[model samples]
Target: MNGRSRARALGVLPGPLPTGPLNAITDVAGVLVGHTTIDDGADLHTGVTAIVPATVRALPAAVHTGNGYGKLVGSTQVDELGVLESPIVLTGTLSVFRAADAVLTYLMGLHPGELSFNPLVGETNDGFLSDIRRRPITERHVLDALEGAHGGLPAEGCVGAGTGTTALGYKAGIGTSSRRLDAGGGPVTVGALVQANFGGTLTVRGVPMPVEELVPGAGRVEPPGNSCVIVVATDAPLDARQLGRLARRAIFAMGRVGASYSHGSGDYAIAFSTADPAPALPDAVLSPVFAAVMDAVEEALLNSLFMATTTTGVEGHTSHAVPYDRL
Candidate 1:
């Protein structure tokens, strides 16, 4: 409910190129991000609902990536035909199925007589700071985050699902960044936001630093191994194949911050473009254009890592803030 500036954090990639107005995923015209943080009871360090709304009613588009290891419900249909018709919800790992169900239920309620609604829900584990086993997220929380979604700069750090996330050796949470691409017609925008639940040695601009170097490790939650979720959004007209490429480029952003994509890391990136509406047919003859998708994906990856601040989470887990002063 309150807003504050994040501490020093590094981008997954370099900067200096043109960025969107807010340098956030929401900058991708019509995209919105919202969150709800639950910090009350001694052990209730978790809450739910972080939503990125669809740009238009029954919008047509294609999904470019696939993850066999994790479940991105509604993505299979999206990849088969390269289109999406729903909002995106990010949450704690165990809440994926529940959130997906809630999203479908909500959509059905909205449409009244709709046959299907493939809700998109993504998850990252937050058991270290939160009681994931309790499944703290609820249908009401999901609706609250969705109803509150709006186009503007998104909040960062210990908020929303990110409340329990960690990154590059510190307690980290939601971070966002964006860039404008040189489209032939005009500049297309691509932006990225992340829920950082991964941990390891912290490095920025090739300068290596121990995660503990920034913050002491006494009487705190030990950083979990790598596990992070990145959401990339753009307004470039691109097909599924191109979007997949963009998703891969996001790893470069992770590399810039000294990530090795460890065994336990659930490093996943989902990239989408709102430039062209998704047609409802599987065989719709839509001309594909992807110049902007490439640039936008790369930029968005950087944004996810850059805009985050250091945080401390459950059991006194503390992470050093990106030391802008040190830089």
Candidate 2:
């Protein structure tokens, strides 16, 4: 929206499904997204991104882990209970606990008498381009992201949790996309927001990007201990088990964009439904939703890379943006 182009604008369509109006995760009704970018123009370049549903009540949700080399706070509870009672917060690796604590603080303030709370907080390493050791994310940053959550197009690339992240040898940050599926019962929307920080070959629609040719001297040096966290939201009445299936599809979509799923990469996807309590969709009708999730996830990952601008951070380290002309 800020004069920045997305993958679609650059002619990189991932699949056949039609995208929602905004072509973003916010296209899912009542889902709000906010970001707190902590860029000091010097060392700090990390911040937080919050995904808040319409209300702070339990919603059907599930988490799937592709490679578990990083932290994902409050995941087990969601898996066990088959619901999420908190707004999902994402930030840098070292700042995960602080973000989770802040989410707890915010949720507690909303419901004073609630005795227990499970705050979903996830993270990916941003040490390559940011002073991650400083752990600059704070309670205020997390709260700001949550409080400012709004429905519409969300800012992507070098913002929020993805500020200092890199993927496929290029700068990447927050990216989102959505798909409207026409199923047997009715139409349902599936949206995905990705914090892409993993390393791979940089493929777009089955074509390997010429990273070496485009950016000479940029060898295949994958970042150490990288990761990606994807959040999928849908308006379909999907139970936790169904949501888990969607989440797995999201993780699988990563490979479509050339994700290596390396040993040190922690690839995780959290899927939730915003529909009111109703009969879950039949398993037979879930194939379209799965296809939608895959398409959205792949496009979102590319948006994270395409929309990102070259960033210079900690100790003069720079993560180059994907060359649009070459693409």
Candidate 3:
């Protein structure tokens, strides 16, 4: 079960922009998010998350690599073809290959006789709190996540692929937020989902917080080679190039929340559009979409921390959630 309020509920991350009814990625019509969490007595902690876009079919998509230190299958195909042939899956770094294979199998089952399909899978290291050596995440977890995909708010923080993730020295996990923007053409919705495992100084708005002072043993125990995976979805019509630009803006949202962007961090973002309007929205109007990306990304990151509960795994190593009172 979720433990605390999201950042907006605490009045620390609200902006002028409004959120959709569920204030989640699902707010972008036809998008669904699901999770499969694995928690074995103190040693194995890892799982899979699946994001289904547009429900019934593939959609136009784009990807941006802020830091290329991790594995992300099918990114090249998505970039080359400007299409997303499969649902997006997120899991631990080492589980990416298996997860991709599982995703392909799952999709193939959905469309039997489909011989070839590019599986989009993203990952971040969760070894710090998980017995990653066990390779506990299996095809079953992938199938479960895909089968259980739902169109309401997703389970965030310490769930699914975020089960064992640690970020900004806190027990961070799955986080999501969405924004509603008016492009003069009509109202467009931009939503963000983040698997937070990267390290960084923690900040709120423009104020950098002394993380170690707030959470004991924060900076000392977090491992190196951390990573973060951001996924953005929108109802606005945008081609692959425009979507790539939107992906970059999602990274800017990381800076807003004080990401360290360290050498070993694998920071990547993927963006997709549910709409395919002719000519697309005018480039001049993309500013609202960009701003929406930044807003949703920042708030989602905060929610990853705010909603997370303390975790203890492998050898009694503990990753504590940020104390709610500090806010």
Candidate 4:
């Protein structure tokens, strides 16, 4: 939607399900997304991404950790209480804590008398391209992302938290996709956003990408451990337990995109529902939603790679973008 070519435009459809109007996480009613990219000419290529639901109050949510190698602040509480009380923020690994603090600062202003709160923040290592050790992210950057969130198509690739990220040896950043389901009792939309920075052979649909042929000598420059953070949103009435199941489906979708889920890869998925309080859907009707999650996630992961531009950062490390023409 932002003028950049996405997976669908390239005939790389991940599934048969129809997408929402915008084909983004924002397609879920009441969901909003925003980003604050910090791209200094060189050395610093990092920033923040914020996902906010309609209300500030706690919403039904769940988290799934495929590999617990990275930090995901406030995940325990969400797993225990089955709810999220703050906007979800994503950023570079080292900046996670600072981002959480910023979320707390912003939420405190919204609820004056609230004595306690849990801020959800996730991260992926971007040290390969960004000067992550410097921790360039500030409270202002995080605040800007939260305050600027809107309901519509969000910018993808080389932006926000994805600025310096890479996936499967290709430059990748933020990517998003959505699906509309009509079989789960009624029409509902499911959407996913990903900060892809992991390792493995790139795969599209089911075919492995010819990375070596397309980008001669392209190889991993980062250290062993990398990470990916996925955020899934739906407008269906699902309880925390059900959302947990949905989150797992999102994690599984990574395999469809050739994610190795390596020893050091901290892969995580956080799923939440925007539907108002109501009776949860029966287990028999959840299959369609699960399928939608996998499809949306696969497409989102591909979008992260395809939409990204080649970037050079940190010392002399360069990550090449996937050659769309070759694919």
**lDDT of candidates 1 onward, in order:** 0.61, 0.91, 0.87, 0.91
The TM-score obtained by model 3 is: 0.97
lDDT per residue as tens, model 2, 1-327: 435689989888888999999999999999999999998888888899999998758899999999999999999999899998999999999999989999999999999998999999999999988888898888999999999999989999989998989998888999999999876579999999999999888988998885777787766547777999999999998899999999999999999988889999999999999986378888998999999999999999999989898888888888888887788
TM-score of 4: 0.97
Once fitted onto the true fold, the runs of candidate 1 whose alpha carbons sit more than 4 angstroms away are 1-13, 49-51, 54-71, 216-225, 277-316
Candidate 3 wrongly placed segments (more than 4 Å): 216-219
**C-alpha positional error of residue 249 in candidate 2 after TM-score superposition, expressed in Å:** 0.2
Question: 1-327, model 1: which lDDT tens digit per residue?
Answer: 333343222333444456677767788787888787776534445445454646534443443322234455677766666556677788887878888887887788778877966787777776776666788788888888877888787776667877776666555667776777665455567777777766555665567766445444523233543466677777666656666666666654666566656666767666777766342212222121233333443343333334445444556555445444443
Displacement of residue 220 (Cα, Å) in model 2 is: 3.3
Clashes of each: 10, 0, 0, 0
Q: Looking at candidate 3, what is the lDDT of residue 188?
A: 93
Q: For residues 20-84, could you state the per-residue lDDT of candidate 4 as single tens digits?
A: 99999999988999999998868898899999997857799999999999999999999999998
For lDDT, candidate 1 versus 4, the one ahead is: 4
- Please tell me which model should have the higher TM-score, number 1 or number 3: 3
Root-mean-square deviation per candidate: 4.8, 1.1, 1.3, 1.3
| Every model's TM-score | 0.81, 0.98, 0.97, 0.97
Would you give me the overall lDDT of model 3?
A: 0.87
Q: Write the per-residue lDDT of candidate 3 for residues 195-291, one digit (tens) a residue.
A: 9988787788787665678866665456666899999999998888889999999987898887889898999999999988456887888988898
